[model samples]
Target: MIDLLLQYGLFLAKTLTVVVAIALLMMAAVRARRGMGGSDDGDRLEILDLNERYKSLEQALKESCLSKKAYRAYVKAERKRRKARDKAQTEERQRLFVIDFNGDLRATEVAALRVLVTTILLDRRDGDQVLVRIENAGGTVHEHGLAASQLARLRAKGIHLTVAVDKVAASGGYLMACVADRIVAAPFAVIGSIGVLAELPNFHRLLERHGVDFELHTAGEYKRTLTLFGENTDAAREKLKGQLEDTHGLFKDFIREYRPALDLERVATGEYWHGSQAVALGLIDAIQTSDDLLLTASETTDLLQLKYSAHKKPIERLLASLQSAVAGRLAAWVGR
Candidate 1:
């Protein structure tokens, strides 16, 4: 029976090996096909006309819900409005360029944000505004700082910028939002967390118990502090604490610079508040959702939603499909 089990295990391993080889060969063929396709337009900026989209929705609703007479009257008025709008083409209409940022721990969306900002800077006319519908629970310091700086570029160019938060924008996320000219958020959206923190578990005791030695060498006095695999000395702890305090101080200073009216002592306690509470704390200017703001603006102004999507290669597509399939299978197994 043990021998039979071993044979079955070997057969399974061989089957897996064959499957992997076939996948690799198929991926190579796809890569070759892509190489021959030429001219990858992966960095293209996609723009959606929110005005036309809203109009289409409104027209559809009216057609379905309104009386025939009301529908005809609405169509007539829309035609006249369209004619007048076309005739007044000489007068430049104000545009609200909308973008979205869904951030993770690394603020990976910054890559696409930079591209969108560059494109807008090139094509934007005077009186045009930008509305960033941002959703991020914060991440690393340098990455979020870079994202904020990108928004600052718009401010430098004298462009009006508004950041709208529907869910949460804590710590590093707030860092980016505070750079906007105006920040609007939903009533219950989370805001603030103006502080810094660094913590890690040390495995020195565990290693020592296992009779294993972990060595770390450094030249500078404070080269490494509160390491993962080494004993944390009091000096190292103090150094790390001092560094965190310094980072928190810098964060407070940054917030104060953008929002002079905010009392740093009160809000910079690494605590977050809902959007309505944030208004009282002066963390956000107003409590309004992005959808409402954009819809209202679309009445007289042209609202354009801009998105930058990277072109995926054939291998990426295949990998993504495989990942989805594996995830689905795991989910089903867990449910069962």
Candidate 2:
């Protein structure tokens, strides 16, 4: 009977402590709301209200013996509130998305850029333009071809797209630059590399010396033009050369379709030239850096960089914080 009474007294003491903490939190929230002038539900008011509610609820949980269910409920509510706030803020602004494709390109970069372009088109104003600062030395035909196709989407939407080449935009990189409505390059930038090439290594002699032999079977006559371990024939070499020429023809045609004024024969010689020479050769329109253009335009136009970044959700952050707290306490006990 005495033990039962002691248990009851402890429960009542914990309940009273929780009640006092809740009362203090409510009072603090009320004071904060009043101090904020009880304004209409604007940005500031919404933020302040969320903060107060969060603080009060957090205090209640901390001071009382909250069950797991109640803790989860509070965390969900906080997450919803934060998500709503983030959506509101994101919708309130107009931004310009800049895609900088430098060095050798990769497929992942292209995928990230596809999403970025779609988001910008949906979020930006109708008149806003996208700036692609290109500096690619050149790479595989198909790899850069896909990159060029991504840029072409902007043109399909009738959105103004500009490409600025600073250091170099050769071969497949030039393929991408030509898709832009306006092409700007620094005076000494290397531009243009209108050609295609393929290299193959043969190890038939090496394998023959090692007493190893390999045979390849193909259903089609030109299925495999060149081989690494098999002997290469003149017919195979001619076929490969024809393929490269065909690809080069397509590259020249693409440029002609976009910039009709270009002399196809002169520019398609697999040659690269500086920006000034390129401008004279009709490869680029004017000489200008992206920074200079942005600085000058900022006087009248707003310069904004549009980016879509994934951040940890509020629930995830809260869970991480809770785990960290538990770990810290466990470590402290172990240390003692």
Q: Write the per-residue lDDT of candidate 1 for residues 1-336, one digit (tens) a residue.
A: 999999999999999999999999988887887899854456677999999999999999999999999999999999998998899889888999999997766676798899999999998798989999988777689989899999989999999999999987888889999998899999988888888888687899999999999999999988888889998899988999999999898888888888999998999998888899999999999999999998899878989999998777899667756654553453233223
What TM-score, computed on C-alpha atoms, does each candidate reach?
0.82, 0.62
lDDT per residue as tens, model 2, 1-336: 999999999999999999999999988887899798973332210112223444576668654776777777767887898698677764433333466765353322455566667766676576777788887766678878888888898888887888999888888879989999889999988888777777777999999999999899999999999899998899999998999999998888888888899997998987888888999999999999987876555433445554433345689557656654553453233223
State each model's CA lDDT, in order: 0.87, 0.74
Sliding window of 10 residues with minimal summed lDDT for model 1? 327-336
- Given candidate 2, what's the lDDT at residue 170? 83
lDDT of 2 at 313: 63
In order of listing, the candidates' clash counts read 0, 0
- Model number with the top TM-score: 1
lDDT assessment of candidate 2: 0.74
Among these predictions, the greatest lDDT belongs to 1
lDDT of 1: 0.87
